[model samples]
Target: MQRMIEFPTAFWVSQYTIRFAFQEEISAENSRNVRLFRTFLQQALSADLLEVVASYATVTAYVKRKVALQPLREQWYAQQASIEVSVSHTPIQIPLCYDEEFALDMQRVMDYTGLAYEQIKQLHLAKVYRVYVIGFLPGFPYLGELAEALFVPRLAKPRQRVAASSVGIGGAQTGIYPLDSPGGWNIIGKTPLKLFQMQRAQPFLLDVGDCIQFYEITKAEFRQMEVNSY
Candidate 1:
């Protein structure tokens, strides 16, 4: 059985704004519930009625002033108990190059995790990662709960600046830097893919709840692909 808690009376911060919060106690055993809750919100509410955001364990919905809070809350409760979302299983494949030059923190990762280069590569490529959320940077998708064996902590001190297209892992999360910016995550590798291409109609490649996988590519292949524009 699923559970949901709701707030009523429309807690008003400003005259035009009201707040309602729900905490869905999702199972940690699997991330399926997280994905289901995301899809449910996308389906149940009209495009203008509410704005929904999902994290590893929680889903928060923000409704506009014109929308009725009570009905929205009730509908959310009903949807939580219903099993209806058919989430797509098609995983997006990303090509990565882990050459020492690209992997700025390769030795650090080896020292921290006590794993050889091949072991690290195997663990990273072995599992299918889930797109938990897209925040922190535009088009930057927070992926995983990487296999326990590959987990590593964030950098003790963050770099003043990190290059765009750099891939890194911190704690249970692994992500690619969508643009050049200050970052603290341990750099593992880099990808040439334009994750957030402003020229594209959609702009963002990965959306919330999408699945992702990474495959290793050679330096030569990376250069050729960079020129060829796959």
Candidate 2:
């Protein structure tokens, strides 16, 4: 049985921003709640609403003035009481290349998690991941809830550059670097899929509520697929 998702608590965080926080662990349900709340908030947006950030457990709205806050707050709760959080989600299959050339820190991750390379890759493919939020970088996704046995900590010294599309695991979460950037997550594999395309109608390929499934592929297959993308 599922517990009802009550309306989240909201408080004024700044003169022009208010944050609505949910009381639930990081799960697909909570992710849906955040997504729904964010979607609902957009309906009440005025010129005063400067920005909105929907995160794992909270939705923060930034407005132009304090006077514009109350009406938005009233609107949010009204929608919260009347809106439905759960929506159908489509699972996306992401092909991953776990070859040594792409998996820079696989050995280190294996050492830390006590998992063999095959075990690690197979385990990763077995579970469905939820897209909790898309932040930290353009089109960068923060997917969550890795199986506990595969949990690994971030590198003590962050790497100067983690190649784009490199799949990495940090603590209990797994994510892909949308573009080449410095990061500390343990690199386990690389995904050939284009997660972010600048010219596309929607710059981001995945949304907050979409599901992700990782599957293994050989280096040759990865190269073959890469050729087709261009």
Candidate 3:
């Protein structure tokens, strides 16, 4: 984050949208650019901006068919590299109950990773994972780059209904199921915290570029906590 450098990127445009693809590998540097671009976008774009989304390595700007986009493109080139709006790297702790009652598929995860329960738990809590993007479900954070030893494949068939706050991993990424929704991520734990609340000013608990740290909790504690987890 100390680097006051302008990272390289490629700009692509089509009839309805423009995309700025970060050319380098995903890192804190690229994440900073995304933060800056997101901030600039909100301040620069008006109703002409139909929709905007930032991904792991790209920012997509959607616009109406009749809107001319050259001006907005200029705005990006002028200030997209600024880091004034960079997100805080502070790690937010999420309490997870890994007890069998909540850890729906612990045995499966251990069998696939060839790891003991302690190893799996420690490895996940070892590093503060960065949120690369938010998608798949409302307030569902796509957090990443799991330890190679923790790598596992998705279930052959997706689950019909997963409980909200259920923490799971598929392939190389991990995430929470905000609401009881169909998903394929192998469930290993559940969080007591409310990840999304529609009535709150900021509905989502985690944002792109924010860091997450998971800590263990007991089933009793999970139940003791109030239902309003916001």
Please give the TM-score that candidate 1 achieves against the real structure: 0.80
lDDT of model number 3: 0.78
Every candidate's lDDT: 0.74, 0.82, 0.78
lDDT tens digits, residues 128-151, model 3? Answer: 788888998998998886887888
Per-prediction TM-score: 0.80, 0.86, 0.85
Q: Tell me the deviation in Å of residue 57 in model 1.
A: 2.3
Better model by TM-score: candidate 2 vs candidate 3 = 2
Best by lDDT: 2
Give the deviation of candidate 2 from the true structure as CA RMSD. 2.8
lDDT of 1 by residue, 66-95 (tens): 556567667766765564337676789998
Clash number for each model? 0, 0, 0
